[model samples]
Target: MDARGWDERYGQTELVWSSGPNATVAEQVSGLKPGTALDLGAGEGRNALWLAEQGWTVTAVDFSRVAMEKALAAADRRGIALEAVVADVTTYEPDRSYDLVLLAYLQLTWDQLGPVLRTAAAAVAPGGTFLLVSHDLTNLAEGVGGPQDPAVLQTPEQVAGALGGLRVETAERISRPVEKDGETRHAIDTLVRAAAP
Candidate 1:
């Protein structure tokens, strides 16, 4: 979606997504030392805010002005310092590298996704990590809730292959439970974690 579309959607909703960090992201980051972090496509700054509370310096980037404002307001209410930026994910260039570069649910076709993923991976500092969690391509046929379009969903191999220089620590499909019609069904996701040398 474009920035305007996202801004409009964010303007209409109080919280379009969960207020907390992604479960898998929290689990994976639990053992890592706190450091500078980047959250691209950070809609409401859930991951960024949680990371800040964990003592990491975090920068949240999203294309929507409304989303950025909401994230800032939440940051203020929580007495947490966050650097939020309004920029396009496909074209954004970080000013410096970070210890943790996170991309959560930033869906795009491979043509648009490849360069951005590579750029984000390149922004990882030495011994740092680049983590991604997105709706798997298989989520459509065999999974519950997520985008129905096949163009936006990604596969584990596609994501792992995009990380040029990092050593891939984990590249596999994982299961997530989703509530639908008062029933909990599962959704597949591609989780990719790579570390810089």
Candidate 2:
């Protein structure tokens, strides 16, 4: 969906996604020391806010104004500060390197995602981590709750292929359980964690 479409989806007053950080994000990032961080395609800034609460300086970038507004408002409510940037993540250029660069569930086709991932990887400082998580292409057949279109879905191979220089620490498909209609369903996700030299 385009930014306009996302704007409409986030126009409501209530939060659409969960207020807390994504489980995988908290799991992988909790071990690392807090530092300068950048969150690409940060919908509602959940992860960004969580990072700030952990003492990391965070910058949250997203194209949708409404989504960013909601995130900033939520930050205000929690007495946390974050750098909010409204811009297209696919082509955004960071002015400086970051200790941690994150891209969570920023679904896009290879034509769009390849460069975005490459650019984000390049923005990572030496010894820093670059973590990415997104709905896997196999989620449609073996999992639940993700984009039905395979064009936007990704795999570990696809993500690692885009990031050529970074040393990939972990690249695999991880399953997450979700509750729907009182039934537990699993969703598959591609997780890639790389380190910059």
Candidate 3:
């Protein structure tokens, strides 16, 4: 989906994603020293707000104005001032580098995803970290939940390969409980945390 499509979807929904940060992201980066952070495709600012509360200066980027407004509101409620911008993550560029760059559950085709993520990863400041979490391609058979389109799902090796010059901190397949039709299923996810090299 493109920016307009995401905008429409976000406008029609009160909250499309969970109000909390992704579990893997939280666990992976929780021990890192807090600093400036960038949340790419930040929906409703959940991860951004959480990072801000944890003492990181956060910038939340999304394509939907509605999502930014909601994120700002959430940040205000928490007494944390989070910077939010409504822009296409594929093209948006940061003014300054950040200590942490986070991409959580960004479902995009390989062709469309690669360049954009490469751009975002480049914005990580030296000594900073880049984190990515997405539904694993193996999830189609070994796990459950997430977009059915295989184009968006990637293997851990694929993710590692896509990133250049980053020290691989953690690359593993993780699981999450997915709720569907009043039942819970396991979702296999690929998690990667790399430091800018």
Task: Give the number of the best model, judged by lDDT.
Answer: 1
Kindly provide the TM-score of model 1 when superposed on the true structure, using C-alpha atoms.
0.99
Tell me the tens digit of each residue's lDDT in model 2 across 14-61.
787889999999999999999999999998999999999999999999
Better of 1 and 2 by TM-score: 1
TM-scores of the candidates in the order shown? 0.99, 0.98, 0.93
The digit string of per-residue lDDT tens for model 1 on 1-197 reads 79999999999989999899999999999899999999999998999999999999999999999999999999999999999999998999999999999999998888989999999999999999999999999999999888999999999999999899999999999999988999999999999999999
- Candidate 3 structure quality by residue, lDDT tens digits, 12-44: 877888888877888888999999999998888
**Candidate 2 off by > 4 Å:** none
> What clash count goes with each model?
0, 0, 0
Task: Give per-residue lDDT, candidate 2, residue 40.
Answer: 99
For model 2, the local distance difference test gives 0.94
